[model samples]
Target chain A: MSDALPGSLVGPVEIVGAGLIGTSIALACRRAGLEVLLTDSSDDHLRTASGLGAGRATTPDDRPQLVVVAVPPDHLGAQIARALAGGAVVTDVGSVKVGPLAAVAGVPGVERYVGGHPMAGSERSGPLAASSALFDGRPWAVTPHPGSTPEAVALVEALALLCGAVPVRLTPDEHDLAVARTSHLPHLLAALAAGALADAPADHLALSGQGVRDVTRVAAGDPALYGQIVAANAHAVGALLTGVRERLDAVIEALAGGDRAGVEAVLSEGVSGTRAIPGKHGGPTRPTGTVFVAVPDHPGELARLFADAGASEVNIEDVRIDHDPGRPVGLVELTVDEDRAEHLLTSLESKGWVTHR
Target chain B: MSDALPGSLVGPVEIVGAGLIGTSIALACRRAGLEVLLTDSSDDHLRTASGLGAGRATTPDDRPQLVVVAVPPDHLGAQIARALAGGAVVTDVGSVKVGPLAAVAGVPGVERYVGGHPMAGSERSGPLAASSALFDGRPWAVTPHPGSTPEAVALVEALALLCGAVPVRLTPDEHDLAVARTSHLPHLLAALAAGALADAPADHLALSGQGVRDVTRVAAGDPALYGQIVAANAHAVGALLTGVRERLDAVIEALAGGDRAGVEAVLSEGVSGTRAIPGKHGGPTRPTGTVFVAVPDHPGELARLFADAGASEVNIEDVRIDHDPGRPVGLVELTVDEDRAEHLLTSLESKGWVTHR
Candidate 1:
């Protein structure tokens, strides 16, 4: 048997604090065939996570081979200290690292502690929102303080590896700045949009289209946790905000000058440059083919068409439909792969479905 | 023939102007089975757009039923006057309605002037980048001046409808203010991000992620055109900027107090609000789905795995590969519809792939 801290073997992992980060870690760990030891002060959280099979609740006596402390930033330092003091190879998944690092100062065997953050998430939080594949292909940052032993760092990196995450090495300071600009600042901008809209009449919001939605997608994150993220990384976020402010000022100056073409130019720039960012899975979203299908205006017709298309081995990557009750025409737009596009078209054609390029 | 304009059946719809808006509008119009008449003083622009099939060159003797002027805001009023001098229902797709309307001076047959904007686009300019589906499912604002004729307004509204856009009515003042907050201000903010990054070391840009990209998406727009837009809409855009600036000052002040928790609280609020914005196509982009596949450590193994997945009629929504060169095991994450998810899993399972919830 492998002589690890938690057991004679290390097939399972133990996690403390089953909140969003903790539960997600649990989920990712479980997917990797590791038994998980989950411990949360709140029985409710533990019960919920255990119910989802993230892991069974455990105590230190359970002899967890590996322990992860996924707690609030303020509690992170002490928790890591306690875990290390208990002789477990410990890692804390917290957005803020310095404060926690300082908190654990001079703890015996502190070299066993490693700092980590899986840079993937949604606005939602809690165990119920957990999915086993949360960290499948996201960037995970690992920061080893000057005092951390190479062994501890290796274990943290191994954990990241097991979860299928890319381990990006960074100093604590660098990590904070990077997140402020990339994650926290974007959140603040999104907040501005939503807060502005909160005052709008409901009908206006109901009529809002995809642009508004895209601009405010991150606004729905858990309030307190995001607050922590921002406060911890304010300097980096502030720099980004300052840049944004300058641009705003330039735009305002242009508008004041009655330069109609100027404003159009500014908006068009946003359209092009923003598209460069990668979408899901780090792949830039570029449309390969657009196929328009005419379907009958009948209940269950969409399901039937989809089923028929599936039978013909046509995989629809994305689907959007335009319905006008006042007219006999309905346009269904499908985005698909270049290779399979012709096949999808031919399959639909064979099924007598009216379509166009 | 439908001779609504006697001796005026132009080669197609007469589209004056060949900038981004002009080219995009032409693309949509031509795609919808409409013959197009295109004229731009710049032979280069006309050639580029025509080469890309934005429209066909046409003669004035072929009188067209509709003539669209998609020019700079300052030039809109005069262009509308000239287009209407021919007695065809004419319209201008400009952002600011009041300025252009005032410029028109309520000429004879003033009712023929309907000002419209298909509330969609990008920062990229030029006809070469035009797409027929740019305006699909977007909100198109059709603003009618007091002098606009019912038929003229109706014709423009019909055009917007034909292009598969939702028609929303907004007066000139309301349109200006609403856009200042939504479009104009966001442009400025994105520009600021770009400007700041411009000052950042070039290597830092390599570290850029989606957060920076999303927040600064509009900054890369054609600086010249944007200048025109901002200048024309200054009053509204300026006022919105003032509001944003004031809020930002408050945030800075909070942080200065070292009220870390408080600062974090406010910032998190911003993040929560931003997440509420929908993703592409007005849907939540919170990712779902995961795929587990063991990859060998050999070179090109991971690439081959992805290629195989791509070949199996699956669009890999997102990817995460844990890095461990020695025993490189990759857990690939993919997003798929809930229905086809099982089918995909089974197929992978049949091929001896390992998957877990």
Candidate 2:
């Protein structure tokens, strides 16, 4: 184990895949003035990534100080094992950590391998969809196995930093369980909710509102890719699903028995759960107020509304646009600091914008 | 039955409740130069609604031409029944239609009663949260029962139009089932998904991303209110929950058995379900491209970005702000017409904004 301190990682950082995540990491490394060696099974992807200034093609003579495996989940273990044989510190950007870590356990250089998963991605894939800022300010879990050296962990953290992400350290098992609750569980729920709509009558679907749109939004993601991701984290996901099924059964029973209190209990739990989520900036949730403004459905309306909002000097925390059918206007909900909501409402109203709380 | 036309609705429009929907309806009617008579069980709500110019206090001798019942679900049936005794064309803005319709089925003036649901509301309740524009450009389901007269239906449809909404006609049963699928089902699913996170450790919650946030957003609604909602449509909601449970079982079974193909099939159905949702303007879904821009987490940054985006003359269909913990920046995703994405990209890039698709 090389006991490298944070920011002590030197080039060349070899990326084993030239897909979206791999190429994006390579671009970020290049931006940090590091030598990135890129390779891929597909010649076209490698050529395109290198041509885009992500990195140069890897040569047989090149010796890498760090190797990042960014291939599909099935290929992760094999790639990590291959990278480990080169005597370089290895890490992977796979979604699940436990399975892959277990795959490479007892390998000759297992001590030099740390697990990482950057919590950022888009529905689009391939090298063309890569961006240097893909992981900017996102959470990147650095999962270290018991046998992993601190130096290997530090290097993985440094790599996350290089990609403009905040590194959160957790054990490989902990990482799996955490993501299972946050990512896999939510995805499955979304898919299940959305699947019910597949054969729905047009009248039922026509009644769809922003709520359904939001719940089903992520369900539109590529299935095959998510299947592998979920299958990799099955143990943790299965446990959570079992818990969810129990709750579902409770809700069903409550509904059937006309048990309002039972239904409300479940709903109250949901409210608390929503509040449990940390607000932006990773702090306790803050109180916010929403200001609704009706804007005409046109190009410059938002710019105008936002400019007016900016003039109020109230920081906008979030924005949601609700567009209804057969309407020439769209409602824009602006979430702001609770104390400033009234001020924003008054400011926009005074500026001739129709506003509501 | 008078056989009235769409524009034949004339006031005095008497509102049975002075809650959010009732007060908003009063305000909308007032905006259209109608004489509104407001009443509420609570003196404070009545005073507030009347003081806000929503309407005048209801008088004993007033013979209203139309009555809108907007009380809580528990009181909706009684209110609608009482209003029908006044020989007025009655409508209730309750979420579930069948229950209220059934409650007034054999009333003397039942033929004059038409069920209505504005399909618009806020998490915030009471008269203070009311707005004249609440129903503007939104869907208003005009659900008529078997014995409903055309005159009553036309009057209700006119009321929807007067409030700046497009009236979507559905049978009372159809309305209930439709909302059960679109609104209630989604809410329950959101709650179920969010409930799993209630007892999650801080570390697990820290891994939360936009997907989980979006899926769980609606779960934060008032428990008692949602309980009433989900309970009112219990039959339909319960049926959907049963269907959802079957899919859940399939997912759990697939995960346990390591059936990749089974998992992929469920996810694929979700994709198709998401695609079936109509786009804005109540048309088939349109292909839209998302342009992501990094904005500083401060006042005026969004304003500046929107200004630059507006300059490109690309009509933004939607906007989402993703804020990460410990980040001084937020990612703004602007959705626009797919064909014009490149134009907007180049235009924004020329203005020194860092953007990605």
Candidate 3:
């Protein structure tokens, strides 16, 4: 009962599923001081999500102010229709908006339903991994059909705002193409990279680096959901793959002939052009702020080593410990203040701490 | 000049072609208190390198103990042959070792030649960009053929040591495959990603994000240089591309009609498989430290802003600036000592610093 957040701000949200996305939406809504009702086909998932404090389960006597339909693209229209018929201002969260919108458009009083998708997620799946802050400061698209009411659109926008998401306006086709380039294409590329190494000897793969990990990060996404998503939007994805294939073909041709100039030109183009792409939250993706350190082994040594950092009031945003068991040392990635990094290293070394430059 | 780095090291060296690699090698050699005779086809290039204290120009009278052939891949074999004819122990710093090694293998008295490719570089080209620290702590692969003199191999490794670079022995084929997977394929991928926007209007391209920029960063490399490298390693690169294409096809198919379980399984495989990849210095890459700061557009802001971090007594390692020109504020990426970051940010904010969740 934080009065600072109004009734409109504190949602009466009913999530129709308790899978990853559904649980995440519930978690986020609850965090914002909302009353969330979560229902799902799987009672086990509901229990898990509930244990995570996503929201308290509710009965039908509580009329939801907004209903978010989080289900498979195939089953999405039905869920939205059910929410609307159940007398709730409804929205559906699905990858492809057009198909579901088209299917449900003929439904009487379709304006009660608005289409939305939060374009931020992780490879982690299931209700067990639902995050209350998953929707924080990310893009959320709302697709409203011609018959959609202004109140419906406004309500959807309010949900996005409350969830700390940026609202983007686009036609169904525009949204499709944009995601095809950004979201869907990256997933395809990552999957392709991952699939190539599926059968590789484990030892060879251990030698892989950040580049491959980065290129294939998205490949870890849920294939079934992705399949259902891509099928609904095959034309856009197919077109993108065709472009990738053409470029790859040109690269192959240049390599076959040992044409140094041709190969370099293509590579150069990629470097220059990619710079223009914005980073998350519409920021330039600038590279900075990482110091890789190699350290020596000793059970109590790491704890003591970090003590100095603790004394200094530094915060490590991320850490990676890569140590071969037999080796007497390890490599640690310490994300720290760039300006103070040189001084920290100097101080650490002065304290008899070993470091990899 | 500083005395020798207290390590048992070798002497007067000759470096051919004072480009980025050659000049950088010269600088490293000179830093180790070894006299180096640097040669290049362009006197201007040689002078620039010499100005950077890389090395002095060589005279015919200089019979160097070690000779480094830092020419283009296509020109390396001929150059190594000439250097060997001069009775100098030689090595070529070319991206493709097998091709050049084959081209010069039968040259008279070829035992003195060792083939090398330093697996580290930047997109920028030219001798002016050379730095002694360029190869420090990076991998430098040395491929000594059967006929290579043991002394030559040792000398090449000694050079790598002087540059503070680790010496990795890769068979020509292993080396080819590694570069193709880690370096070449990434370039192609990045290029294709970047080039996709080539057809996009400039304004639309301006909205590119971090993911796209990251995937495309390597695309800005020199086209001519890449062409030579790719042409030389056609088979390896071609195989990698084919692998990429197959994987991509699978992803597309899965996304089109696959279920959530299927897609998530595929994505999970990628994360687990890729997390095993080693980082640049042979460790896994991790998220660097991070600090979220609310920065406003004000005069003398950055300096005063970071001054608050002084309380934590930790130096910054890297900095990222994210600003929206239209907005009055921005977010700064401050990477610092991991342990100190939390206390520092807290102290900074307590001093009236602007920050947000």
Worst lDDT run of 10 residues, candidate 1 chain B, spans B318-327
Question: Could you give candidate 3's per-residue lDDT for residues A1-357 as a string of tens digits?
Answer: 123332254567899888778888887788778888988888898889889888767676877878899888889888888778777678877887888887787776687887888765544467875666555555678877777777778888888777666677666666677666766666656555565565554334443444555565455555666766766777787788787787777777777776566667677666656655654336555443433454554333444555655455554433444332223454455545556555655666677664422
Off by over 4 Å in 1: A1-12, A27-35, A201-209, A238-357, B1-13, B18-36, B43-65, B106-109, B122-136, B194-213, B218-220, B258-357
RMSD (CA, Å), each prediction: 7.1, 1.6, 7.1
Shift in Å, residue A57, candidate 2? 0.9
lDDT of 2 by residue, B29-74 (tens): 9999989999898999999999999998888899898999999999
Candidate 3 residues lying further than 4 Å off, grouped into runs, are A1-10, A18-24, A27-33, A42-54, A72-74, A126-132, A197-210, A220-225, A258-273, A279-357, B1-9, B200-211, B243-276, B279-357
Estimate, for each residue in B251-288, the C-alpha lDDT of model 1 and write its tens digit: 66665555666555555555644544333344454454
True contacts kept of each: 0.19, 0.74, 0.26
Output the worst ten-in-a-row residue range by lDDT, candidate 2 chain B. B1-10
Question: What does the lDDT read for residue A212 in candidate 3?
Answer: 57
Q: List runs of model 2 lying over 4 Å from the truth.
A: A1-7, B1-7
Tens-digit lDDT string for candidate 1 (A1-357)? 135542122545779899877887887778777889888999999999999889998854676656899888768877888787767778888986766777887888777777888776543468876666556555788888887777678778888877767777777777776666556766676666556655553323323543444455456566676777676666666666665666555555656665556555545545554554443334445555656676554334554566556666644544545422223344565556656766776787788886545
Q: Model 2 misses residue B108 by how many Å?
A: 0.9
Instruction: Kindly list the per-residue Cα lDDT of model 2 for residues A1-357, writing each as its tens digit.
Output: 234454477778999999989999999999999899998999999999999999899888888889999999999998999999999899999999998888889789999999999999976789988889888889999998988888788888999998999899898888999999888998988998888888888876778889999999999999999999999999999999999999899999999999999999999989998999989989899999999999999989999999999999999999999968767789999999899999999999999999888
In CAPRI terms, model 2 is classed as high
- Cα-based lDDT at residue A285, candidate 1: 55
lDDT of 1 at B279: 38
Q: Once model 2 is optimally superposed onto the true structure by TM-score, how far is the C-alpha of residue A18 displaced, in angstroms?
A: 0.9
B209-257: candidate 3 lDDT, tens digit per residue: 3345445545666677677777888898888887676656555565556
Model 2 score (lDDT): 0.90
